[model samples]
Target chain A: MTTSKSNFSKPLILVTNDDGIDAKGINELIKMIDSLGEILVVAPDSPRSGQSSAISSGYPLRLIPVEKKEDFTSFKTNGTPVDCIKLALNFLCDRRPDLLVSGINHGSNAGVSVVYSGTMGAAIEGAIVGIPSAGFSLCSHNPDANFSACSDIVTFTCRKLLEQGLPQSVCLNINIPASDKINGVKVCRQAHGYWTEEYDRRTDPYGKDYFWLTGQFINLEPDNEETDEWALAHNYISVVPTTYDQSAIKYIDTTRNLFSE
Target chain B: MTTSKSNFSKPLILVTNDDGIDAKGINELIKMIDSLGEILVVAPDSPRSGQSSAISSGYPLRLIPVEKKEDFTSFKTNGTPVDCIKLALNFLCDRRPDLLVSGINHGSNAGVSVVYSGTMGAAIEGAIVGIPSAGFSLCSHNPDANFSACSDIVTFTCRKLLEQGLPQSVCLNINIPASDKINGVKVCRQAHGYWTEEYDRRTDPYGKDYFWLTGQFINLEPDNEETDEWALAHNYISVVPTTYDQSAIKYIDTTRNLFSE
Candidate 1:
C-alpha cells in the first residue's frame, strides 16, 4: 500500500461512486477527469444504491486493492458509499484531497431523491471533512447508458470548482438529463417532491408474503422554474448546492414559541 | 390487515424507531404518549443504526405483525427505518397519521449525527408526508439506560406538536442530555461537527486485514451557544427544527456565477 504522504506539487483528487468501482458511469467519469489531477479511487465493491449516508457498524470492513498505476490508484471495499469516503479520507488517501467527486450515477438523484441517494451521501461526507465535493448523475438507469454527453459538462464544472472553492459545508448535486443534445446548466434549488411508494406484493414458494419497493416521483411544484425538477424537465443540467446541516433556521423562533408555553 | 380509511374522530399517531421493535427506548416512548392519540407502530425487526434516509429497492421486504391491541398495533419490517416509514404511510396505516414520533433513542442524534440517524430519517419521512413529527434521543447508548427523566419532556413535546402543527417539510430533532435533572429546553440550530473516524485494524486467521469503524465527534463550534452541542453540554434538551430539503439557498447566486463563465 502507498503511504499517505503529502505531495504539494499537484492536486490530489479522490474519486468515488455509489454504483461500485466497476460501473460504466464511474469508469467514464475517471477517464473524463484524468487530466485534472492525481487520482485515488476508493469505492464499494458492489452497487450500493439508495444507501444515503448509511455507515456499516458492528462489522469489520475489508479494503482490497484492485489496481495501481503511476498517479492513479484504486481500491474497493465491502462497505457502503459513506463508508468508502470515510475509509479513503481516514486511512487510504496520500494526503488531504484537493477535491472529492462522487458518481456519474446510473440514475437521477434529482429532486427529493438526494435524501435517499448514496451518490450524494459520499459527496456530503466529503463536504463534512472540508473537501470541495460534487456528485453527478444521469437521468437514465440503463447499465450501458451513454455518458459521453455529460463529459464536457462534468469537466467544466470540476474545473470551475477547482479554480474557485465552494463555501464550507456545501456540496453540489448535479443531475444531467438523458439527452443526446444538451441544454445549458442552471443552478437551482432542490425541488419539493416525494416518492409515491407502491409496493409490489407477491407470495414466496413457502406461501409467505413479500413486497418489492417501487415508487413514482411526485413533483409538488411542477411549474416552478427555480426548481431542479423543472430545470431537468427542460433538458437543462441542474445543480443544487446542498448542505449537511439541515436546520430550518427560519422556524427556530416559531419552534421556540411552541415550546416556551 | 387494517384498511387505510381515514378516521378523523381521533388523532392517529404513527410511532417508530431505529432501534428495533423491542428496544427499551422505543417502549418508553410508546408508553409516555399513549394518551395523546391512537398509535400504530411500524419499525425495523432489528437495530438499524446510522441508516439515514436509506430505502431498500432491489430486494423484497417482509413485514411481520408482532402485537395487536385495541388502540395500538405494531408491525416489524425487515427494512431500514425510512422503509418502515414508507410502508406505514403507503401500505399499512388505517388512515393518514396526524402526528409521527420516532425514538427516545438510546444514543444522542444531535449535531451532525442527525445526518446519519435512522431516527431522524423516519421523522424526516413523516415531515415529507406533511405530518407533524419529532425524534427524541437521550445521550446514553446503554441498552438498559434509565429513561425516567425523559418521560415528562417527551410527553410535553408531543402534546405541543399535536396542538400546534409543525410547518410542512419540517421536523424536530430533540436530544436530551444524560443528566437526570435536565437544565430545561432550548431550541437551537444543528451544530457544526464531524466524526474523527479511527478504524481499528486487525488481522484475521486467514491472514487478511479488516477494520472496525469507530470515532469521536469533533465539534467545530464548541463555544457557539446557539448550536445544539452547546445546549446539550449545558444539560438542556436541545430542540432543533430540521428540514429534509437540504438546499443551501444562499450559495445559488455564487454557484450560478461560477457556471456563467
Candidate 2:
C-alpha cells in the first residue's frame, strides 16, 4: 500500500493492452509492475484482437474506472490499445509516465504477427509519442493460458529496461515460452515465417455470408539459428527490437544500379 | 501493343499502395518498377488512411477491376492494402511474381507507425506467405510531392535486392527524404521517435461528439548517424533491415538478474 514517492523520483509506469482488463496475463503483469513503480492501468474494455495499431475514427471513446488494488489504479476504455495509451497521456494521467508497458499478450508477436498485434502496436505508439515503451507476450494462444512463468520474467526485464534504457523510439518485443523451464535468452532476429491465410466460409443464422479469419503459421526460415523462431524452439525467451521505418534502402542502390546507368 | 518481353527478361513486379490508385507517389513508384520489370497494379479503391492492416470482416470484400493501359492488369479492393495484396496473390497474379512492392507512402512510418501502415503491412503479409516483399515510403506527407530524385535510388536498391535476395523473412524499410536533392544511401537504424497524442475534439453535424487523431512526432535520437532519422535528415535514403520478430531476449538475463533469488 506504500504508493507515495518523491514525485519526481518515482518513475510513473503506464500499463495497457489489446487484451481487455480481465485477462489473466494482464492481471499477473499488473502485479509485477505494481511492486515496481507508481502505476496506472488503462486497457481496452474487450478483446480487440488483430486490431494491429489501429486508432478509432468512428466516435470519441470514453473511459470507465476499473477496480483499484493496493498500489495500482485501473481504467478501461472502449478504444483500441493505441487509444488507451493516448487517453492516458492526454487526459487521464496527471503527468507523463516515465515508462509505458503493453501486453503480456495472449500469444507470440515474434514474427509476421507483430503487424497485427495490438499489444506491440500500443507499445510502438507509446514509443512514437516519446514514452519508453514495451510489449510482452507468452508463446501460447490459449485464452486461459498459464502466465506464472511470465510473471518472473516481466519484473526482471522491465526493470533492467528501465535501468539500461532502450534505443530511442525502439520498444522491446518479449515472447516467453509456455513451459516454465526456459533454456535461456537470445537477442535474435525475426524468423522468415508467415501465416497462410485461409478464411472459413460459413452462412450466418440470418442467411447471410460470413468468413472467419483463420490461418496456419509456417516458418520459411527453419535452418536460420539467429532468428526468434530458433530461439523460441530451444525454449529461449526471444527479444527483438522493432520500429516503424519501412524503407527498403539496401534494395534502393541495387535497384538504382539497374536503371541509374 | 506488344505484351511480349523482347529486349528484357527482367522480373515482373506488382506495385501497389494505401494511397489511392491515382496518387502521384504511386504513379512515380510505378514508373520506377516498370523500368526494372513488367509491372502490374492492384491497390485500394481509395485512401485507406490509418486503416492499418484491416481485411474485410463485415462482408465479402468485392473487388472491382481498375481500367488501365496494357502491361498493367489492375484492380481496386474494398478492403485495406493488405487485402489488395491478398487478392493479387490468390486471384489476380497470372503466376507468382518475382517480387511484390508496396507503398511510396506519402508520410514517414519512422518510429511506431509501421504496424499500422497499410503500405508496410501489405508487404509484411506478402513476406509471410513466401514472397520477397518490400515497402517504399517518402518522408513527405504532401499529396503533390515531387518524387523525381528518388526514382534512381529506388531502381538501384530494388534491383539489387531482387538480384541477391533479401535475408529470409527480413524485408527492407526504405525511407527517402522530402528534399529535392539526395545524399547516398545509409544502412541505418530506425530513429527513436514518438508522437505525443493531442486529439482534436469537435462536435459532429448531428451534434454528436467526434475526435480526429493528431499528434506531433518528436525524435529523441538525432546525433546517431546509424539511424534512419539521421540519414533522412542528411538527405540520404535510410535503409533499415526490419523484421517481424518483436522479442526482448537481451533482457532475460537482466530480468533474471533483477528478480530471481
The C-alpha interface RMSD of every prediction is: 0.9, 4.7
Residue ranges of candidate 1 with Cα displaced over 4 Å: A1-8, A68-71, B3-8, B68-71
Model 2 docking tier (incorrect/acceptable/medium/high): acceptable
Clashing pairs in 1: none
Candidate 1 TM-score restricted to chain A: 0.96
- Write model 2 residue lDDT over B1-261, tens digit each, in one string: 122233346676777788878788888888777767767688888887665765554356545667776566676766678777766665556566778888888987655566567787777776666566777889888999888767866787777767766654466667788877786777766666566555876676876544567777666778888777788888888666665544444444543343333
In model 1, what lDDT does residue B53 have? 90
lDDT of each prediction vs. the true structure? 0.90, 0.72
Give the share of true interchain contacts found in each model.
0.87, 0.29
* Candidate 2 share of real interface contacts: 0.29
Scoring only the A-chain of each prediction against the true A-chain gives TM-scores of: 0.96, 0.91
Q: Give the worst 10-residue stretch by lDDT in candidate 1 chain A.
A: A1-10
For TM-score, the strongest prediction is 1
